[model samples]
Target chain A: MADRREPLHLIKSRRDSALATLVSGVPYLAWLGIRFDRRGDELTAILPYDEKLIGNPLLPAIHGGVTAAFLEVTAIIELAWAGLWEEMESGRIVPDAAVDSAMPRLPKTIDFTVDYLRSGLPRDAYARARIVRSGRRYASVQVEAWQDNRARLLAQATGHFLMPQG
Target chain B: MPQGPDLTDRDQTRIAQQFIEAIPHARALGMRVDALGEGTATISMPWAEHLVGDPRSGVVHGGVVSALMDTCCGAAVMSHPAGPASTATIDLRIDYMRAARQGQRITATAECYHMTRTVAFVRAIALDEDDGNPVAAATGAFTVEG
Candidate 1:
């Protein structure tokens, strides 16, 4: 059988580099082996199924947090691919950084609302994000999850990117 | 404030503090309680370095968004008179209208539209400081478990 596993690629750009450094320290996501694959305006990420992510052992449902996380990441990456990263770095956006950033001036997720369309089972899941709208100051993105060709729609998220003034 | 059997100030404070303590990520994300009453609760979080997918360019991650919504809903449920109830989300639908600007602190306001003995229905919207337009909208159902 052909290898179905997609190779992981290091995210380019200074912001992505910093994000990778910070995310590596997360114990839970690190354990899940989440990998990102970027291609033009689209991004595909995989979250390997792990026992820790299961909410109910008997029913074998993935935790809602895990699903939310997966969807959130997918949307962020998609926005990055769409070229909204520059504005976000400048800190001229809404849903301001005070709530989302760990460090001063670093724009992080100020707020995110994810809708869980379906339950992620005990199987590995995949997510894809598409940029719904992108502008100089703000951008919007959408994401969906799939398992074995069935649409799981783990979650959908919308983000705001602030641009710096000259 | 309209007089109703809403969550008391003490109860709201306790639940907010508990929620901040219970979820490590939520705490790490710097989630703050804005208000809790009338079957509704609002929370705020600063955009952090790790929360962004591209730190140099500055775009926050969507995973963090979902986490915020989940936390808000959970807190909203706990703010109810039942006192610290455990919940499992049955369905959460999110609609993204725009991307959150980097360095912006996003706020989430969640309202428990309907609550019964076994289930709670909630809807939340995340918006920037101006609060002019919503970045995302979500509605979900939570099963209250003992």
Candidate 2:
């Protein structure tokens, strides 16, 4: 049992640390107060409500651009996590050491489309990204964001990215 | 684009300024309205270290460009001859042509190309110092409310 638990423990800590490093690399993500929650290989991004994120004062809704930004961040980070999984599983990268150096170059955005279905209320928002197709040089991701209900999405986005060259 | 009654230049400036001031995100980014016509608007924001996406590249994030374009498009819709009192994005598509250079002001110009009873269509482009090259381009549909 102890033996069985060892690699799982390593995987969890390493994954968390690696993600932390990636999140910290982007100054804008920090400025927007975006954080990630990891469930094994899946990640859910969280954007806590802040007054500075409001775009329409009368509606008191979150800025459309902020919603797009959150979705894009989710897609990029999810893509990075997916690519980093193999290396982490194989122990190619040192556990919790030199994470910044081992950081995979983030994919660049090619294009992004966002659909605002509903006004984003002035509250915390959550998002998840699904990779539709990830190729050697390109990737497509779909993201959904919601404020209160997971079933009802406030916004959704589809983004294409150019993968970093090895 | 069909012509609607245009606001005076002074009225345009005042209204545009009030619109930007009411938006928290626009104020946070220090977005300024440079020009406003009957159905066109131009907005610009200066570079700041906090807005950088990649430290090594020192490039502003794509989101900043998106926000600028979105705001500019909405401003154009609001200034249209139809005179939408407010607007909300229905959908927006952004194409990032190139990474914006750091330490330069980025400007976006948007045109309300079409309008219907309740919908407005807009297109916008963002540029830095490079006169001909654009950092990003965007097209969007927004709800028109009076």
Candidate 3:
């Protein structure tokens, strides 16, 4: 999307934020057409539904796996987004080109569970993540996805990811 | 009472194959139905550029594997004897054991382990030819039409 294509150079000049760089550089997020809106410390993800995402044609609803992945990807990106700020504040890495070399941490999914509350219609979907705990070696996240109304969830998921040290 | 002839296993297989092929997302994913039996189904996906997650490693995305597994489960449910007239995914859980090697066709097989009036349970595993071990394991529950 026009808004999602903010390259690293533009981000550096505009926002100077590592999370912004990662959001643009990550190839998978772009492929899935996911965009994150940062509101203070909380993050909200948007998935503009497309015909490519429909699984069951009978009802023409979005694929359940895509919905599940959308939630999982949001949680991982949220961690990386928040972790960048944490690492920057802790001063473990210098705030120069070294920041580029020390990329934001990538989490390896250990296990994930998704509960489908309702069929995801062929329209925009929003997701938000809740971090249950983040430890030295792992992190737990709970995520919910909805369309139109946040209270009416299409799906809810929880995942445990191995925190790969940078 | 008038009765219609029961569908043979051969006919059921043909119907299942057709149903799997008709899924819009399955068509987009290029999923091929390899087999469909009484309680089991197998779907295979060839390596495609769009399916890659880590470009550096060239490993297939975890989500692709999940999609394959979920589709296979759905196909299994469709062909199972106790399968409902219609169904929707209720819940699914996936555990990744390892990544599939690059450029290898991944295959997933799923079985309907249990079925009640309102729900059916499924378990599945994904693997590629390069490795004997499974790439991922999953269990899912589907809501059945009563």
Q: Best candidate, lDDT-wise?
A: 2
User: How many pairs of residues collide in model 1?
Assistant: 50
DockQ of each: 0.18, 0.85, 0.59
For every model in order, the fraction of real contacts preserved is 0.26, 0.85, 0.55
TM-scores vs. true structure, each candidate: 0.55, 0.94, 0.86
| Stretches of model 3 off by over 4 angstroms after superposition | A1-17, A89-100, B1-15
State the local distance difference test value for candidate 1.
0.64
For model 3, how many clashes? 0
Following a full C-alpha superposition, what root-mean-square deviation does model 2 have from the true structure?
2.8
Cα interface RMSD of each candidate: 6.1, 0.6, 1.6
Q: Flag regions of model 1 displaced more than 4 Å.
A: A1-33, A36-63, A72-166, B1-11, B54-57, B82-84
Task: Report the C-alpha lDDT of model 1 over A1-166, residue by residue, as the tens digit.
Answer: 2124423342234445434533443333454468765444345788888775654444657767678777666665455434444343443432223344432232234344555566667888898877666665655566778777744465555555443322
Off by over 4 Å in 2: A1-8, A95-100, B1-8
TM-score of chain A of each: 0.60, 0.92, 0.83
When just chain B is superposed on the true chain B, each candidate scores a TM-score of 0.84, 0.92, 0.89
lDDT of 1 by residue, B1-146 (tens): 11235767766566666656545456656788888876688888898665655455565655566667777876787666665346778766666677788889999999887888899999999997769988778788887777
